[model samples]
Each structure stands twice: as structure tokens, then as C-alpha cells.
Target chain A: MTSKALENGRRSKRHIFHKAKVNRSHAGNAVVFTCILILGAFMALPFVYALGSAFKPLNELFLYPPRLLPQNPTLDNFIGLWTLMKSSWVPMSRYIFNTLLITAAGSAGQIILASMCAFPLAKHPFPGNKFIFRVIFLSLMFHASATAIPTYIIMAKLHMLDTYWALILPACASSFGLYLMKQFIEQINNAVLEAAEIDGANIWQTYIRIVMPMVKPAWLTLMVFSVQSLWNIGSSTYIYSEELKTFSYAVSQVVAGGVARTGTGMAISVIMMVVPITVYLITQSSVMQTMASSGVKE
Target chain B: MNTNIKLHSLQKRRLRDGITGFLFTLPFVVGFILFIFSPVVMYLAMSFSKLSLNDAGAMVFENVKWDNYINVLFEQPDFLKRLASSLGDFALRCPAILFFSLFIAIILNQRFHGRALVRAVFFLPVLVYSGAALMFSNDALSNDYFKLLSSDSDETVNLAQYVISVLGGTEDSPILDIVSTLMDKIYDITCSSGVQILIYLAGLQSISPQLYEASSVEGCTGWESFWKITLPMISPMILVNAVYTVIDVLGNPTNTIINTLYSLAMDSGNYGLSAAMGLIYFLIIFIILGAVFFVINRFVFYEENI
Candidate 1:
């Protein structure tokens, strides 16, 4: 009876400690929440300020101390931007069309090509596979900016300058995309591929039917990355034709028009960012999953 | 012998696999050689040759030599200083960005309400910081902030100055120096941190919760659990994020070195010098990355959990 009482006392002590732990966690929750909220606000600060300024009138664009929100919000800036574009020689719609065409085609091509190359590098045991993979990783070490002059020369030689090919072809064989996809594909179960092989599916058929579906999350993540990168076609310096000018290039031109065009510049900025943000929101969870699995092994 | 027959089939299978792999990678290989490799070779040659644009706007290489390299390395006055400052800037900002990202990732990994929304908010910057969006948003914030600070119309004292006065530190005190330098580039700090934060979050989430639970049962504090379990488990990712961040930061088009190269080639009509400068800068970056990989590889831990 004495031993039983002692056990009961210990159980009660443990229950009390658990209760305290729950209470302590509750207190911690409040602190953590506040910290996250502050960080979120900070992250959103510039975008918020720009969004506000986009709606503000021209006179209010550069107000000292910079009001967080416009006192008298208006859609005039967007209207003004529309008129400004309407007056341009190229017709702003054409710029948008060019951008969408180049970006869509380029990004799709990049994803497909990168995935194709990545499959062999990730799963196939071929001669020079390791050497090729190492070469691709090493390519990532250098800045693409440093290659601009030579790339310009290459495009010129291929007669691709002043054409959309200049923009699309160079971006299609992305080393980083290949590396990312390869790392992700390496994590898939070998058993699944072996099973497919036993089912009499050829290499191409397996890659198309089985491997693609299995790595849907990864490719979607790649799509998000590709779309963002392709959408941001700042001056291709190679593509100088007025007809080939991209929407981003047009916005940059207007934004460079100085203090008078600040409101319209902000409006253009908002328009440009909206698509990528939506894409990111939809794909981020999948991105997080793939990235966690894709962490490089030492 | 029976062994010879089995070896013959094995070699045939190997040949098939190798051929299939090559077929799969064909398009990428073709494009890679044409677009990347050829240009890289051309770039190296251009660095050692005088280049001029003909009336037809085609590039012509003449007088093949290392004069461009010599001129850039010794003749140019501002090249070395700019290189030093940019590298110094790169070195200082990387640790700050990594530390901040890791801190935010730790907090974000904890269970909380509206966690998805918070994560999205943090990630929004990454999505938005591209092309025209980046141009306007960053310019808007930093431009306005600078105007406000320099206006001197308000009664509010400078925050950094006030802190300095209170602390009574000399001009070169490490703390004061870092703070003052950091104050100027606050916009860059906030903008460049989004990707690193996502990376760290990925690393943190990959750690098994069971490890933490077991540590707690062993009478370990949260701090102790983090140091002993979380750090080692995520060391591989730390190295990945570090390499990624370094490359991303250096590759930014707005970088001073890149800007100088653009002006040299486009404005000053010095393509050869620009090419040489770019090559040298790239070499320096490669060396830096190699050193970083060497250092970090020693600490990276690969788990056999899978």
C-alpha cells in the first residue's frame, strides 16, 4: 500500500509538470507570433509603400518622410500609364505579346531540356556521367554577366541578334536548372524505375510516363523559377529592334523618364510583379517539398 | 567458359544503357556546346585580343596579345579599388544575410497560426524582386529614405548618431563601424534575404521531429537541442545555401564591376579591356568560391537516414 502511494505521488508530479509545460508553451506562442508579425511587416514594407505610391497623384509621389499610404488614392496613374503606352510607336500591347511569346517558349524549352539532361545525370550509369555532372556544377560558379560580350559575339555570328532567338536559345540550356532537376530526380525511388523497366517500357517511355508524373512537384517548382526568370527580360542588349523590345524593357524606359513618371513607374512595377507573386503562392509548398529533398549530399 | 558468355551480355547491356543516356541528353548537349562552350572559348580569346566593331556592327578581333590584361591590371586607376570594395562588400553582407535567414527560418519552423500566410509574405519579395518590379520598388524605398534622412528639416536626430553618442565609441570601434556601414545598405539587406530564408527553412524542415522529441526527453534545453542536433543535421544545407548565396550576390547585374564593364564596352568602346576585366573578376570569384567550398566541405555532415 505504501509503494502504491509513492507511485501515485510520482504520477501526480509528472502531470503537474506537463501542465506547466503547456502553459510555458502558450507564453512562448505569443512572443513568437509577435516576432513573426514584425518580420512580415518588414518584408512587405517596400512593396506596400510602392503599392500606395502607385495609387497616389503625381504631386504626392515624392512627399518628404514618405507617407505609408496615400491620403487621396486614385487610379489616374494607371490611366496615365495606359495613355503613355498608347502614344508610343511600338504599341505597348505588342511589347506584352513579344514578352509573353519569348518567355513562354523559352521557359518551356528550358524545363524540358533541363529535365531530359537531368534524368541521365541523376539516374543513368554511363561513362563520363560523373565528369559531365561535375562540369555543370562548375559552370554555376561563374557569373553569366561576365559572359555577356562573348554571348553577344556568338549571337551575332549565328545571325540571331535582333531576333527573339537571341533571347530564347541562350536561356534554354540553363546549367542551374539542369543541376536543380538532377538533384531532385536523384531522390526518386530506384525501385519505381526498375519496376517500369521490367514492365517493358523503354527509356524515353519511362521518362515521359513514369518519371515526369513522379517529379510533378519538382517541375512545377522549376516552372515557377523559369517563369520568373523569363518574365524579367531586361534589355537583351542583343535584341535591339524596336519591334522585339520586351514589356520589362518598356517599363524600364518609362521609369527612367525621371521624377515626372514616378507614379506610372510604380503602376508598371505592380503589373509586372503580380503574375510572379501569384505563381509563387501556388507553387511554394511544392517548391519547399522538392527543395528539402534536393539538399545536396556531401 | 560460362564466365565469358555472362561477361559478353553484361557489356552489351552496358552499351545499351550508355547509348540511351546519350540519346536522352542529346538536345541539351548540342545546345550547351553551341551556346555556352563556344561563347566561353570566344570570351577567353577576346580577352587577349583587341576587338573592334566594324561599320556593319560585327565584332573583329585584331592584334592578338595580352595588352588588354596589362592595361586593366596596371594602367587603370580605379579598377583595383572598385574590385577591393566590391569583394569587401560581398564578404561583409554574406554572413549577415545567412545569419538573419537562419534566425528567421528557426522561428518560422515552429508551430504557429497563420504560418502559411507568414511564409508567403516572407517569400513575396523573392517573387517581386525581378525586372521592373525590382527597379521601382527598391528605388522607391531607398530613394525616399535617403531624402528623408538628408533633409534635416525634422527635429528627430539620426538614429545611428544618437546610438553612437550614447555608447561613446571611437570612430573605428568594430561595433560602431559595422552598424554605420550596415545602415547604408539596409535596403539590400532586406531585399537579398528572401531566397536564403527559404533555403534555411527547407533545411530546418528536413530535420526529423523525433530527434528533437528524444532530446527533450533526455533533459536537454531547446538551446542545447539546437546546438547538438539541429546544427550538425543541417550542416550540409548550410554549405549549399552559402555557395548559392555567394554566387547569387556576385552575379547581380547591378554589381559595380558589371556596371563598369558595361560602360567600358558600350560607352567608352573598350571591348577588349572590358573582356579582360570581366575575366579577371570571374577568376577572383571562382577562387573565392573554391576557398569557401574547401572550408565548408570539412564541416558538412551527410546523414545515412535515408
Candidate 2:
């Protein structure tokens, strides 16, 4: 049957399926392309606009009927932002260091811990596994802000308030990464694990050496997610000290300079946005691969 | 004697596996207990108490029987009103996001030029709009700028209104109202559906080409095959995206209910009242998710061997 379709020269070498309206007609293709182009423009608008606004001179920033791209671009905002950073009480590098520390620790801990927990839950059917999974699933429904007060109280009780742990520990405990890793782990072939077991590998050995390597895409995706969230950790309910504040918190402080510093504020926003987008760009393929198996099964 | 020895070894292995599994999950268990479980309990307690700060800025809870809940539910109608409106918005946004993402995903899955670039563009929001980035992007100045641009586009909106009227639909017609609401929220819908589109694209790629080949051989058109093959195969992702969309929309910082709760806690310093409101809001979300899961579970097609 496929041979007949192939003989008709309808199948494109690039695509998997034979073309029998499966690949759209030219008009349909044009429509789809147009739709994609339009939507893509809308999706990219905010970043582009922020970039343009950051480059706009102070006089052009508040122009009525705002242009999508700045008419007169300048590096005054970047210069101003640099000058402002130099004048800060806490060194600008300190804020960057704090953000890097938190992002690195939080992301590493989240991925390692989530992958560790997910392996057992996915492969081993131990007692309380289902209940624990359900609890974790239910926890995902609770927004972080909703639980902020209690988390603050708990942190205070632990004497971890105003410390980096306040940010990193809670981030490490997030359930979404675990859930995602588990879903991906479940897609692994059981026979491979069994083969590892037959080689006298214990559960930990199998998890570390075999399962972990097999689920690299999952961990990569998880890393992107964890880094995205951690990189954006601004003012936390728990952390109060100046030195402990993240880069985002610092940028927000610059933004809080009000109307006069609008250009500088936008420059900071653009810088803040670039890091995660770069991470996503690097791991785009792995993230997409992991997402292929991200569906929830009954 | 040999069989008995084999059984004994099997039992020993089972015990070892159980211990290993438990050990593996210990970090999460401890973290969950300390961070999630205890805080949830404390928050529940706080909801039923009057929360005040002492001289040292320590939270002191004075037990108050049902007062906070009563105050949230009855004395102030704002919470409930916001909750209802948020839910209404969720109902509209969730389906629109799902449909838009799926539509985009289908286009993205097709063989095309600049597909990688398009995919990256679609997934950009997953990074760009998350957490603090969103907070920065939605700052007062940017919002004002966006508002100015939107107001400048009022002529286009008026043209839309004229076209609708010419089509014999009043501005206030239910269908036209929905269309206009969706039109206004197109940017928001586009931003939020990035992850959903990724999920859908993933699901689309995972579907076997042989199914399409067989379907075409059996005289199925692309449209027919899509409904017969694509929709059912993608139903699981649909369910996942639906639940995610609901949670995302509801838990969004810009959500009115969330904002109301934040203000009640932060500005008004009504911690007990805010906790009560949060609990109520959580319950509503929980129920809605349960209903979504229940309804969608019935139609979700899970292939056993896929």
C-alpha cells in the first residue's frame, strides 16, 4: 500500500508519511505557514520590544503611539545601568555571585534529588510508592505563593531565614521536576534494567550507571526548567538580607528607581531574560525529546 | 529442599529491593516532611486562627473558631467574587490555549523550512515568561507602554466591531463577546501555550508513521486520519495540557484572586484572613482539577504497548 503511494511520487523524502492530503495542498501549506509566521511574530514581540526599549534614548522611551522598534537607539541605558551598578552599596558582582550560587545549587540539587527519587518510583514498586506519588502530584496544584507564609515560618523555625538555604532548599524540594523525570523514566525499557540486574548490579548501581545515562534527556530538560525557575528567584519571602538577594532582586531594585530610570530598567530586564533563553537554546533538542514522553498516562 | 532454598533467596531479594527503594526516596521524603507537609499543617492551623506579629516580629497565632473562614466567605465578598471570575476566565482561557497550541503543534510537526527556528520561537516563552522574568516584563512602565500601544490600535478593534455588526451580530452577542475576549487575550494565550505546544508537538512526533500510511492506503483523507488517529493518540497530551493550563492560569501571579490574596496578606496584614482565602482558593482549584481529570480520563486513549 505504501509502495503504491510511493510510486505516485506523493511521498516526500523529508517527511515520514506518504502525501495523501497528509501533507497539505499548496494553499493549505501557505495558510499554515502564514499562521505560523504571524504567531511567531507575536511570541517574539515582547523580547524584541524589551530589547528595543532598552536601546531607546530617554527622550524616545515615552513617545506616544509607541513604536515596536525604537526609532533612535542608544547605549545610554547600558551606560546608565553600569554606572548605577558601580554606585550600589553591595558590589554588583556580589548580586551576580549570589544569583549564580543559588541557581547552580538549586538546579543541581533539584535534578539530582528529583532523578534519584524518580528512579525508585518509576521502576521499583515498593510500599507507599503510589501514595507518595499521589501526594507529590497533589502538591503540584498548590501555588508557591499560597504557601509562602508557612514556608517562611518553617524557615524561621529552622534558623535558615535570610540564608541561601531558604532559596535553594525549597527549590530542591519542588515536585514538578520529580514528576517530569518519573514520567520519562517510565518510558525506559524494563528489559534493559533487568539485564543490568542480571549483571549483579544492585538497585543503586542500576539507577546510577544504567538508568541515569538512559534518561539524560529527561535530566537535561529538568535542568533547563530548574535553572529557569532558579535564575528568576527574585525577592523571596524567606531571604531578607542584602547579600543574600538574587540578581533578579537587584535588577528589580534598579527598576524600582521609577520613571526617570525607565531606559536603564529595560536594559536590566533584557539582561535578565537573556540567560534562560540561552540555556533553552542550548538544550532545545533534548528538552523537545524529553517532552515527547511527557504525557500523563492513566 | 532446593525449591525451599530458592524461595528463601527470593524473599531476601524482595526485602533488599524494598529497603533500597525506601533509601532512594529518603531525600524527597525528608524534604516533603520538612517543607511541604509541616508547612501545609501550619498553614491549615493559621487559617483557623488570628495571626498577629509580636514585639520581635514573630508570628503569634491566637485560636479563633471559624472566624477567619467566616470573614473570608461572608464578611468580605471580594474573595468569592474574584474566585468566580477567575474560574470563568480559566474556563475560557484553558480551552483556547489547548486549541491554539494543538493547532500550532500540527503546523510545527509538518515538514517545513525554518522549522527549528519556529519551534525555538514557540518555546521561547517557557524561558522568557517564567517567574521573575514575567515580573520584570510586566513592570508598571512596560505595562503602561503596552497599554499605550493597545489604545493606539483601537481603530482596528472598531473595525472588528463594524464587521461583526455587519454580520448581523450585536457587540453584546454571546458568541461575539467570546470572540472579542479571545481576540483581546491573543497575546496572553500565545505566551501561555508555549509549553503546551511543545507537549503536543512531542506527542505528534511520537505517533507512528505506519498508522498514517495504513490509513491512507485504506482511503482515509488527511482530515479523516487526523480525527481517527491523531486526536485519540494525542488525547493523553490534551489531558495533561488541560490540567497544566488550568493550574497555570489560576496560579498566575496576575490572576485577580492571587493578587487579592497577596494584598490581603501583604498590604492589609490580614494573615489569618489571607490563609483562609488561600485554603478556599486551593480547594476550588483542587475540585476543578479533579473534575477535569475525571472528565478527561474517560476519553484519554492510552496505548498499552506504545
Candidate 3:
């Protein structure tokens, strides 16, 4: 009877109301917090395992079931990676240099070319502009693989196979890039470009001196994107030449050494993967938001 | 005469600007013609002709009269089954990954320590897992991942054989069927490559924070805010991811179209047939992409509202 009376008193009080309110909110937050932690871990797992594997020795790797962390960790893997990278039959540095050049050239080339073409498509009233833009736009709908074989044959007939042009030239004028860039620059006020033109800025001068600076952030964001893409490119199983390989291709070559082979040449891969990753970390920190947004808006 | 000359010069200047604009775009025009347009036209030509790689090391071209297309589509062994399976798998996987990624992305979009790091980590799979990289590192990732489902097989593959053995030991038990079904589900989820997650994370971060603030002031719960604000805002992105995912799946290593192309070109030495198959694949993708664009176009909510 006394417990019932106390419960009745509690149920009738303001203190009870405040206490229950806090309790309900706490429960809600706790559920969200738990979900966030699990999701974060799920997102972070690949990097963890990749880092762990880079540091781990072979014995730990080939264990019946994998363990999450290395037991007897050492820097031997890094040291081995350094030397093994240099010892590769092919010139590793040339491949690295070529990849960097291609990536830079491609991204800059695409952005400039796209920006210029997009200006007219978005701002000007040129005859056949919409038709031409539509042609480029519709080509994007065509699956890349569908064109891969035909493009390969085309490159062959032009005597451009197994060359840098083969790798870089095909994607120079990207349909997706043009569409994206046109949409972006279109959002800018024509008044802005018109004002610049009124101040003795010719079309070329207006684009270079004014429009380019305004879109600087988008440029960096796209560059980072293209770098990340160029870093991971390795579709050259058909373009077979040992000398004409990129880092990703080399890494693939190592990992896919043979059916039974243990893929001992991963020292090069361990080191090479770090280069792009490091570059990405440095550049992406500032514009990660921008890169994310460009993709988002698209 | 002086006024006439000035007017003529102004007209000449306007003409010059148009010519310069065309010239500025000339490199791209040239590239488009040489790389994209010409190849497409050439492929059409090559499709109708049997471009045999001759003994003398040149394309021995002969007109095949619709035979290549007919054979690849209707009569090529494993063609229809493989194509259907690829398409079905793509359909089943796309939505599941889309939802899963959005779920994870929303969770990441919440304020937290290491927010930048978390976003970068989410983006890593997209950066690191190129088609070649995946083909190589799949062994590494899968070997580790496979253990989450079952113990070491003493053999690597042949999942059905293991199922039969488990059944044999249990003698047609209900538990065996349950285990197999659950295993199948796990495999299905794991097989979804993680690109969808990156795409969704990009979409989530694009949502303006002000919307959340406004929604909160209205006494909206997190769930309500998500449904009301976030979903509609990122619908365009979802469409882009869907389209990209569908098209990207065709080029994936396990894809049958890619494998068939590889085999026909290299093994059969019939580049003509492969070209025809490619055309068919491209045609199919074009149709599907058009439908997707039309579907998404009706629902796009532009940023002007926010």
C-alpha cells in the first residue's frame, strides 16, 4: 500500500515528468550513437585491413582464418617494398612519371576544353549548338565497354596502339565532363561574364582572367577526382606491353602473378599504392566537400 | 566611306568572334570526330563485314550479311543465359546497394569527430578498388571475407558441394536449409561492390545544413528530417548513381558480356563478332539509360528551393 502511494505520488509530480523526458531522449540518442559507431567501423574496415596487411608478414596473412591485427609487426614490409620496387624488371619511375603526366594533362585538358565548349553551349545562341551538345550528351549514354573494342581497333589502325596517345587521347574530351562543366558554369550569372566583357575583356580574356578564377575550386575538385581515377587505372590487360605499364597495372601484375604463385612481388604494390593515396590525402582535405558536392549535384 | 568602313569592321569583328569560338572548340571537335564519332561509324562498318585477322597479318574484310549479329544474339553458346543473368544480377544488386549506401551515408553525415577522415575513408574504396585492383585484391579481400560465412573448406570453392555435404551429415534437417539460405543472403550482400556507398556519401554531404537546422526548429525528429528533406534533395544523385552503377556493372570482371568479348576476340579470332556483340550491348544500355533519364527528369527538385 505504501509503494502504491509512492508510485501514485511520483506519477502525479513534475519531477517525474522531467526525469521520464530525459530518459526518453537519452534512449533515442543512444540508438543513433550505436548506429553511427557501427557504420563508421564498417566504412573504415578496408583502410584498416589494407594498412594492417601492408604491415603484416606472410605467416600472419596465410593463417587459416585472418586475424584483424598483426601480432609480430615490423617495418620489414616497407623496407622490402622500397628495394623490390627498384628491382622490378621494368623502370618503375618512368611508369610513375608517365602516369602523373597523363593524369595532369588529362584533367587540365578536359577542364579547359569542357569549360570553353560549355560556355558557348550554356551562354551563347549558336546555331546547331544544342544539337551538337545533345550528340555529346547522348554518347555518354553509350556504355564505355561497348566502345572499348571499337576504340581499340581504331587506335590500332591509326598506328597509335601501345602509345601514350592510346591511353590519354581517347578520354581527352569527356562527354560527362562537358555536361557537368556546362551545368556548373551556366549557374554563374551571365552578368558576371558580361561585366568583364564591358571592361575590355575579350571572350578569351574574360574566360581566362575572370571565369577561370571564379571556378578555381571546382577545377581543383575535378583535378583531384581525375588524379584518383588516373591512379587506379589498369584496364591494359589487352594493351599488353610490359614496358608500357602504369603503377596500377604493375600492382595488378604482381597480385595476379600466377595461379599457384604466392604473389611475392607485392613489395612494389605496397609502395606504389601509397603514392596516390598520399597525394589524395594532401589535396582532398580541403576540397573533399567540393568533390563530394560535384558528384552529389550530378 | 569612313562610316561604312567602321560598320563593316564591326560586322567583321562579330564574324571573327564566331570563328575564334569555333577554333577554340576545334581541338575537341577534332578529337570527338577522330576518337568517338569515327570509331562508332567504323564499328558499324566492321559489324557488317567479317574482319578476319588473316595469315598475312591484316584485317581480311568480307561482308557477312547479318550473320554475326544473329549468331551472337540468338545462337552463340551461353549468350542469352549469360546476358540475362548479368542483367538480373545488376537489377537485384543496384537498389540494395543504393539503399545501403544512403543508410551509411546519412549516418556519416551526422556531426562527429574525425568527420573529414571518415569521409575520406568512405571514399577510399572508390579510389583503391579499380577493376584491375579488385581483380587482384579480391583474392585478398574475399579470402578474409569468406571466413565470415564459413570455416576453411580445405578447398577454395564449389559452394554447392559443401551444402550437400552439410545436408548429408544432417540427413535433410531444417537447420541445414536455414544455414544455406542465410549463407546465400550474406554472399549476396558482400558481392555488392562498395562504389554505391561512395556515391551516396557524396550525395549526403551535398545536403545543405540549413535545412536540417530549419527542420529541427519545427520539432522534426531525425527520421522525419531525413524523409522530408534529405531524400528529395539527393534524388538526382541517386539517379546518377543508378545509371553509373548499371553501366559500370557491364565492364566488371565477372560480367559475361566482357568475358564473351574477350573470348570471341582472343580465342575465336573473330573481332567482327565481338564488335557486333558490343553494338548490341551498347544499344541495350542506350535504351535503359534513356528510360532512367526520363524517369529521373520528372522528379528532379532543383537547388533553387533551398
Best by DockQ, which number?
A: 1
Sort the candidates on TM-score, descending order: 2, 1, 3
Model 2 spans > 4 angstroms off: A1-19, A22-26, A213-217, A287-298, B55-57, B131-182, B201-236, B301-306
lDDT of 1 at B271: 79
Which candidate, 2 or 3, would have the higher lDDT against the true structure? 2
Candidate 3 ranges beyond 4 A from true positions: A1-33, A141-146, A186-221, A235-243, A251-269, A288-298, B1-25, B135-236, B302-306
Instruction: DockQ for every model, please.
Output: 0.34, 0.34, 0.23
Prediction 1 TM-score vs. true: 0.81
lDDT per residue (tens digit) for residues A1-298 in model 2 = 8889886665454244445354556678888788789778766665676789889887777764345578878899999999999999999999999999999999999988888888889889899999998888777777888778888878888999998888889888878778766765665657678788889999989898887766665576567778888898888778788988988888878876667877886787778878877777776555444334322222
Alpha-carbon runs more than 4 Å astray in model 1: A1-29, A188-218, A285-298, B1-11, B54-58, B109-111, B133-187, B200-236, B298-306
Candidate 1 residues A79-194, lDDT tens each?
A: 99989888899988899999899888988899899999999887886888888777666677656766777787678788999999888887788887786566556645576787
Question: What would the TM-scores of all predictions be?
Answer: 0.81, 0.84, 0.75
> What does candidate 3's lDDT look like per residue over A102-168, in tens digits?
6777777777777788776766545677787778866775545546667777788898887777767
Residue B30 Cα positional deviation in candidate 2, in Å, after optimal superposition = 1.4
**Candidate 3 residue pairs in backbone clash:** none
In model 3 chain A, the worst 10-residue window by lDDT is A289-298
Give Cα-based local distance difference scores for all models: 0.73, 0.76, 0.62
